[model samples]
Target: MTEISRRALVQRLVASTAFVSGASPLSAAPAPNRSPPPPAPPGKFEFDDVVRRARDLAAAPFEPVAPPLPDALNKLDFDAWRDLRFRPDKAFPIGDSFQLQLFHLGHLYRRPVTINTIRDGIPTPIPYSANLFDYGRTKLDKPLPVNLGFAGFRLHYPLNAPKVFDEVIAFLGASYFRVLGRDQRYGMSARALAVNAGTEAEEFPFFREFWIETPESGADRATVYALLDGDSTTGAFRFDIYPGVDTAIEASVTLFPRKPGVKFGLAPLTSMFFIGENDHRFSSDFRPELHDSDGLLMHSGTGEWIWRPLRNPPKPEVSSFLDKDIRGFGLLQRDRDFDHYQDLDLAYEMRPSYFVEPRENWGEGRVDLVELPTGHETSDNIVATFQPKDSPEPNKPFNYGYRLIASLNPAKLSPNGRTLNTYQTTAAALGSPEPINPGSRRFIIDFVGDDLRYYFSDPQLVEVVPSTSQGKIVRSFIVPNPHTKGFRAAIDVQLEPGQSTDLRAFLRSGSRALTETWTFPWRAS
Candidate 1:
């Protein structure tokens, strides 16, 4: 399958995004003599100062920066955007371990964020220079505006090897940013804030300004602060990143809602789930699987671990898992076998899964999961976020925070064993001696962990607890799967035609839970 470029995908999404309440600078005519923004908030800038700025911005009407970029630069396409590359020596000098690289403005990215470098608690603006970038083939016969700023910036550090800087994280496009580990490529994205996602009138917030601090020499972490603005809300966000085999970003957010009763989704994750092991809609394709993530994994507040396999349903499906004090949740790419995808160019196996761990006490909320149908793998159709039970009223203060970790093996993310594989078949001929319930479907869920191995020595010691929301569980049994060297829970259930059931299963022996509960919504075919 021919996939679209990431820039093209983001640009398309930006077009669909709803950012109102404020006049956008994109459609505004450019002023010939564009000058730099009238200086930012004065004095030594700190975390609380950023929060104060967000509050102050929320009190007034939004004013966008006027652009002076030539129409020629504004009309470039994806190929032309790719041609404009930042030269190496132009990397921002932050520290010995990390350097910053900026993204050039293009048709896809119109809004230019004010980029500043913070040192000794003071801010200094980074001037826009045409000398910093090389315009490969897009011949710009006219001189561009000297005040034209950048779209966004990416962090480059020696994540893979010593003395070699590799891009570990990037902040670009409408409140969207992506992270990568040592050997992983960018597949999924996490947004700063989501407003009315999965609804008719969804809003996309924008990061209009950024303050990247110079990291201490030889330190392992770097801190970046941002000022966010949108039609519905304004906020301040601080991100602290530690890059390695598994990159972890500690994010602190404070939201100021302009209008009351606006739904807010904190730490939202967006990914692609075109097809996977459970779905055969794309069985005729060259690759067996096409997805950035195949399941949603969560560690609830009550210490119950749940794994919900992803699907491109016939219609838009949204599920909410209520929690009192949510621990963590994330969209996971569980299957890691190269043979599963068989694509040499896009190594689906190397895609990183992001987990959001709550830092403060989230009193009560529901982790919302949204799955939108898609025909191709290029479009991201899956979105998940934490919806608080009670939102702060308009003109009130709302603050939340989470730690985001980008990794491949979520098995190490929590203490409980995880679901290794899951499949549902129409026929129930395997593992059953006699013809059991008529029209009953079969399910095989494999789990592997330390707790399971302790009980797998004696298969009878394990029990499969299966339950359905509105169906009859004909039978349930547990057996040791030699393939995974773990316990496999086999279940049979019968549901009438046109009926849908929410099924859940977990392995246990006596009072001990062996694996996380595997849950799925099934519709009888």
Candidate 2:
């Protein structure tokens, strides 16, 4: 839980940017001398310049650059902090395709980030001004300091409608950002990197500055460059964002470690899984399920696809899948039925899933999934990332490239059959002569896909392959699911009292597998 706070606390609700005008009284205007760096000369500004800064910074002791925020802003609550919004008229436009909206420094976001817009090879730093924002209902007795910088920024484009600008992507907090495609609500978020994520000694790297290239008229994409700094490392990143029905961001990252043997996770994702189809801890609630994502989807270099159902464990849990030349992976929301959630305000079904596609061969690494026990829906309890076997050397450059896709149709990324839903209950049935076995449980998994539908008529040929790491599989069988035009695999497991079990199962026809292997971690009550 302490580590969660180190990396800026995850926000479940989208940060509002609504603009209105109001003012208040403050005692004194406490201004810091902090200001953004001077603009680079035309033709001199480049990605290499960011790399040089990172390299130079990594060579020195990490001096965190967080100046104290004014008391007027420091004392404000969430509602009052959100009331301060960037004026729409102050938004920086990029050609005719996209615009950038700034975030004010207050509340949970006390760290400031420098923002610059590059046009025709010249970089222009955006200065902070009270005129840029509409302070709604906030009473500042004294005027705000001129040196107060921005917290972060969000990018907007006409994604859903041709004329109306919708938020496409946002970069805020500590190297944290979320993207949205058409009709998708903010849910899970992607991070530039995670340092010592699954360990007790976790570190959060912050993106301290950004340089965005102004797009040309009629261009469909935008380029953004960023500088990240932390206690262990410094980095330079380039993100090329494309907005569409399935928005994508191609990320090129270069890291320079300040110390040797530091654990680094590339392309990490953060999400919430308070409850789901397989978890009944809070079934008394009106909603059938509540979660931003249902499962962890992975495609190994061996071409085997794996699905692990998310859980809210009794304690912190970390699972790693060993692999070589990793292909792809992501935290996905497979259940999209509105009836499954039934929440009108949140619209959980419309939350987009993020898929990480590696642009190069990242050889010999493990995909790590960390799930922390949580009682509230606001906390992001699930984190997934890829950790390389070899640690980056001190003062050496480490580079990786990947494509992050935010979409409503993550199912299309998988070629094999996928698990539609998972359920668990006591193995005993009423009226049976057999005594109730408290240690026994039954797991029901339904899988659906294009290939599975073809073998629905010949259910006899399909087989359910089940395995348990610490339990006996009493019985395993497959039955046709007429409703989904797929097959349901049921397994009765007898577990040892007070022991936990790791279960894996998949559907197969003859010698060929029809679906991705479904994995789950079950703990005794």
Candidate models: Cα lDDT each:
0.79, 0.82
lDDT of 1 by residue, 1-525 (tens): 011224224323332332211110000111113232223345667677789889998998865543545688678888998899999898987877889999988767877788999986688888888889998997888776656878899999999999899999999887889999889988999989888776665767788889988766898887889999877889999998889888988888888888887888889999999888878775488899999998988877777888989988766677777777777889998889999999999999999999888877787778887776677888888888888878768788788877898998877675777898888875466585776555578888998886777766788988889988767898888789878879888888888876777788988889988788888877676
Error of 2 at 41 (Å): 13
Every model: Cα RMSD to truth: 8.6, 10.3
Best by TM-score: 2
Q: TM-scores, in order shown? A: 0.90, 0.91
Tell me the tens digit of each residue's lDDT in model 2 across 1-525.
111232344321112221111110000011112232335565667778888988988888897758888888888777998899999888889878999999888887888789999887788888888889899998777777766778889999999999898899999888989999999999988999999876656778988899998877888888899999999999999888889898888888899999888999999999989888877775488888889999988888887888988987666777778888778889999899999999999999999999888878888878888887778787888888999989999889999888888888866778789999999977755567877577889899999985888899889989999988776998888889999999988988888787777788999888999999888877666
Q: How high is the lDDT of residue 237 in model 2?
A: 96
Instruction: Give me candidate 1's TM-score against the actual structure.
Output: 0.90
Q: For model 1, which pairs clash? A: none
lDDT of 1 at 191: 87
Worst 10 residues of 1 by lDDT: 20-29
- How does candidate 1 score on lDDT? 0.79
Model 2 residue 417 CA deviation (Å) reads 0.7
Off-target runs (Cα >4 Å) in candidate 1 are 1-43, 63-69, 430-439
